[model samples]
Every structure is written in structure tokens, then in C-alpha cells.
Target: MADLFDNINDWLMQEALDENPLTSIVETFGRRLVEGGVPVARISIGRSILHPTIGLLDVQWEQDTGQVNTQAVPRQIVRNSLEIFDTPFGELSKGKTDRLFADLRDPDEVARFPMFEQLAARGMTYYAAFSRSFGRTHHLYERISNEFRGASLSFTTKRFSGFSQADLDGLERVLPAFCICLRMDIERFVAGEILETYLGKISGKQVLDGQVERGDGQEIDCAILYSDLRGSVTLSQTLDSTAYLDTVNAYFDCVATAIDEHGGEVLKFIGDGVLAIFPFDEANRPRANMCAAALSSAQEAFARAEHANRGRSGDGLPALHFGVGLHVGTVIYGNVGTARRLDFTATGPAVGLASRCEGMTRELDTPLVATGAFAEHCPRAGADLGQHRLRGFADPIALVSYPLT
Candidate 1:
């Protein structure tokens, strides 16, 4: 066992030295976990050990795509744990997921994990959920096998048994090395891959992968703003579809570029409309003084676009015009919907009100309008645009105009 572990360690060292140490750490140690005294069914890998029902490594056995061994694993059990730590207990993972976790030293919780028994129905015998906390977040690790298949007594015979105390002990013994390997992998992945992915997404490289907030399922005070091209409809009608698409895409580029530069996350793109958030994070609240930054960013974006459309003399290119609305309120900011389909959108009247406020920009002949909540913190911005009665709102709201200096 020492020799085998040494080989795996060396493989990890080589990966750490040569390629991405992060991927190698997960790959090397993840394999050892699955092969440990069980007829493993499926395996999954997560970044850290403080896993709240997430997979660190995953493999499934299939019968038809045709095979003798079959494994059934819950899809949500541990796949997208990248953002689970903040997903409040009982919201995503149950309050007590396992016996070996923060605040769960009780022996009864050892059986609280439903996967152990569920996996047994299909001949699975035993399973385990392991975790470790790294940095400010937690990571999870899981391994399970069928009674008949898990034992795998012979090369030809796949059998399973419930995990024995000795087996669990064995797992406990080698976990330190595994943790070290996984830590290295996580660092590499975050630095080499995740950062680049974030940069690309923020810059709208793979436009489909937009921003989603990974936060607790609770209402948080935030400033939600939306923008849409004013003359998009006429442009699409006058120009061919391909040309219109090109023009709209270029418009998207302008909006995203500004959002990224200003530290805002582009939530989603709706046709020619862009939804985004500024200074979003836990513990951060909407402040009128800081609101200028977002508005300034938006103004700079329009200036750039208008500057670009100057030389397109006869292209029938739509005038680079957009209306922006801002509203500050307690909006639900986290991954919402379901495991299969989730949207990172701000819920509550604040977002819709912001949209409605933006719509007013077209009607009011102004480029920007902010809700009273948005202006609540601005330093002497009341003198600029002043107050107005917002439609659908009972009380009158005070706000400042766009293009903050």
C-alpha cells in the first residue's frame, strides 16, 4: 500500500511540476478513494473537503450503453458544489448532511445521509461522504458501492458490502495525503482555469455563460440596473437579419466591456437588453455615493459606442442610444429555480421596477432614471434630476439624472 501510494504521490508531484497541479491532485487522489476496499459504483471530485453534497470525482456504471455493472447516482448529490457553501442549510444541503461535519458530531447523523440506503437497492452496500474546509470554503468527497458489486470479491464477481469500521478507518488514515493533493489541484484550477473562465465570461467571450450569483438564499440589498438599445427595433426592420445581428452583437460588446471595467457582473442578455449588477457581494449594501461609479461606467459605454458609429456614414446603423434604470432594494440574489435549470437573476419588485424605470427613460426623453432607493446614498445628487412621482409606486421618489460627473 505504501508503494502504491508513493506511485500516486509521485504522479501528483509530476503533475504539480509539469502541468496543472490542481487537475492532477484531484485525478490522483480521487482514484485512490474509489478503489479503497469497495466495489465502487460511481465517483465524483470536489475542490475541498467541506463538501455539502458535492462530488470531488465521479464515474458511473452503465448497463446499456451495455455493461454488466450498473450504478445509479443522484445528479444533484454532488455535481455543482462550486457555490454551495453559501446556499444556506435546508435550502440546498439538509441541515445535518453527515455526522462528520460542523455542528454534527452526533452519532445518529451518520445514518442521516439518504444515499447510503438508496444506493443499496441496486445492490450497493456502503457509501461515505467526506469533506474538508479550505480557505473560506468547504469541499466534499463521496464514494459508494453496491453490496454485490462493491465487494468485487473476484475479478469476475462483483459483490458489495456495507462499509466496515476497518474500511472507514482506512479512509481516515489516508485522508491527509488526499487533502494535500486536492488542495494543490484546487489552487491550480482557480488560478489557471476558473479565473480565465471568469474573465472570458465577464468579457462576453462565450456569451452563453453569463454571470450567476453564488450566495445564500436570502434577500440582500443591492442596486440592480438594466439597459437596452433605444433604436434596435428600427435597425432590425431596416437592415437584413445578419446585419442586424452583427450590429446588436457589437452593441452587446460595448455594454459588457463597460460592465467588466466597472466591476459589475453582466447577469444576462435579453435580445438587445442587458441586465447587470454593480458592487455585488455578501455584506455589501447599496450606497448612493458609490452609485456614481456604475452610472459613470454606463455613460462611458455610450460615449464609446457613439464614437464608433460616426464613420459608418451610410450603413443605416442605428444611432448608438440606450436607456438605463437603477433601483436599490432587498432582492433575492442567488442561484434560483432547479438543479436542471437555474437562473442567476434578482427577484422582487426592485428589478422589475428598475426595468419599468428604464422604460420611462424612453417616455420621459431622458437617457437614465434612478429610483429613490438608488439615490438614497448619493452625495448631493438631488440637485441634478431631483424628485418625481414614479408610476406604479404610491409614494413619490427622489432621484438624480444620468451621466454623473
Candidate 2:
């Protein structure tokens, strides 16, 4: 039995070193426990993680289905769940105990936690929870006395005989290896999430692949889409700080959501303007996909803006209007700015050209304008605007306007 447990520890360490996902690790651990003659019915691991949008990350392994399910619980939703505050897991989190065990077969003991009663109804006769820190060893005393960074592990068995002392001891012995695997995988998940959130997907992967040095870039052909809200300066002057911020966020939602849904990566929100790109493949059909996606995203943004404006009108607020510019060209997309600070963005003539097209929207009295190149590839006919001299352009720039409706 000792040899079997030691083998499991060795296997878990190897898997951790290999960086297998957390879900895969949990599923394997559950299978191993049942193989070792432990009647494991279900296992769950929960951790409060630092994330931009999620508060709790939990994984569950079910014996019947042999499935591992994972979920990200929103911060507010986790706070509102009263059952968590009443459970033994909550007690462990507050430093009340190193481990908690409940024999669900006993009504009085089950009555102490309502969740245990629910588990008993599901044929779960025994429940055990353990907590271990992922932080510094010197803070071990602080961790036991005060809540710290760690995970809470719980196991439930549906076996009629319930979990024996040996079963419980085996779990305790293997948990150190289990926590180490979880920490390694979770760190990978967190780093990926944070990078993707701060940098757009394409740029985030570039940074992760060691493209952090200043001027590290590549020239890529992409359809650039730039959208800027109209009357933002006036709105900012009229509304209070809170109301103005709400208006800005509402406007951003209309544009950003459309771009995101249509497979464009929003690179930055520059004041009231949003910069996004849909990269073109170098294959035979390059422009069709990128240009079409950009056009669809622009149409969706206009429609969403109309809906948002109607809502604002109902609230007696001014209607919001925005202009979109679409252009397809090659640009150097990579890290820029000083050594202390870096910005991942596209730079070149096309970037400036797209911004110029957006500026033309107000002058032409249209919501969307595309460069001649974008219009040619979009497959949709647009009203051609004759060549006109644009700021900083030596020659006249010809463009096409897309209908707002």
C-alpha cells in the first residue's frame, strides 16, 4: 500500500512537470484513488484565484460519469452564495480548521451544515475537506492563523460503509503532491489569462513566445478597423465624471462587443477611439476573410449603436454616434514604446490611413468609410466618394462609403 501511494506521488510529480491541465490531473487522481480500493464517489477542488473577471475556479470529478468539470465563478455571485458561508469549507477558509470531516449518516452531524444534508440525500455518507497553502513556508504559521493563498480540497463518498480511517490517511498522504500539480497548472492558466486580457490575443501570444524586446515586430497584412465616438468631447464637458464614464463604457460596449464577436482583436481604446484588426492569411484567399469580417463587424456595431441610442433616448440622454474606418494593408505589428514601457500595436502607413478614413466620416456625413482597397475586397458595393486631398497625403485618397442602415 505504501509503495502504491509512493508510485502515485511520483506519477503526479511527473505530470506536474509536464504541465498537464488541472482538469486532467484531477480526473487521473480520482481514478487512481478508486483503483487503490478507496470508494471515491466525487472529488472537488476549489480555489479563490486572482483573476481580472473571475473570483473562484473550481473543478469536480464524478465517478459515475468519469468526467471532470471546471467553472469560473464570478466574484459577486460567489459572495452572494450563502451556502458557501455556512459550509465546513467556509470554516476551513477562515482558519477554523486544517481539515473538516462530516459523517453524513449521522443526522445531527449533517444538520450542522445544510450542504451535508443535501449530500446525504444524494447517497454521500462521508465528507472530508483539507486546506494547504501555496505560499511561502515562512508564512505557514501566518497561513494557519490567517487566511492565505491556497486551495480547499473536498471528497465525498457514496459507499454504504463510508470512508475508513485508512482511506482518509491515504488522501492526506497524497495531497502534498496533488497541491503541487495544481499550483503549477494554475499559474500557467493565470499567466495566460492576464496576458490575453492586457494584450490582444495575437500580441499576447507574441509576448509569451519571447517577443518582449522593443522593436520586436513583423509586417503582416490585416484589415484595420478604427471606430471613434462622435460628440465625446462635448459629452465629457456636460456630464459629471461618473455619468461621463458610464456613457463612455456604454459606447465602448457597442463597438468592442461587435468587433470581438466578429473575430477581430481590439488592440487599444485610445480616448473615444477603438483600434482593432483582423489578420489576413497569406494563402490564396487573403482579403476576403479579413475584409468581410471587418465589414460585418462595422455593420453590427452600427446596429448595436442604434439600439443603445434608443435606450439612452428613453433615459433623456443624448443619442450616441460613432464613425468606423476600414482599410487593408501591411503594417509592422509588434512591441513599441520606451524600454521601461512597451505598447503592442500596429504601426505604418496603413494605420495612419485608417485613422484618416475615420476622420473623413464627419466631413462626408456618413457613419462608415473604407479605403479603395478595402472596398474592392469587401464584395459589397459601396458609394464611391471621389478622390480628395487628405491631411498629410501628397496625393488625393479615394474612398467608398457604406450605408449606415
Top candidate, metric lDDT: 2
Candidate 1's residue-wise lDDT over 114-149, tens digit each? 433344445544444454333443322232211111
Where model 2 places Cα greater than 4 Å from the true spot, the runs are 135-148, 282-286
Please give, for residues 1-405, the per-residue lDDT of candidate 2 as tens digits. 456678888999999899898888888889988988889999989876766667667899999999999988886665667665586656776766779988889999899988888889998999998988775332322222345567889999998878889888878888888899888977888888888887877778888889999999999888999999999999999999988898889888998899888888899999989999999875743678778889999999889989988989999877878899999989899989999999999989999999999999999998899999898888888999989777988999889998865
Instruction: Give per-residue lDDT, candidate 2, residue 145.
Output: 38
In candidate 1, clashing pairs total 43
Q: Score every model by TM-score.
A: 0.49, 0.91
lDDT of 2 at 206: 83
Candidate 1 local Cα displacement, residue 21, angstroms: 5.0
Provide C-alpha RMSD values for all models, in order. Answer: 18.4, 3.4
Model 1 TM:
0.49
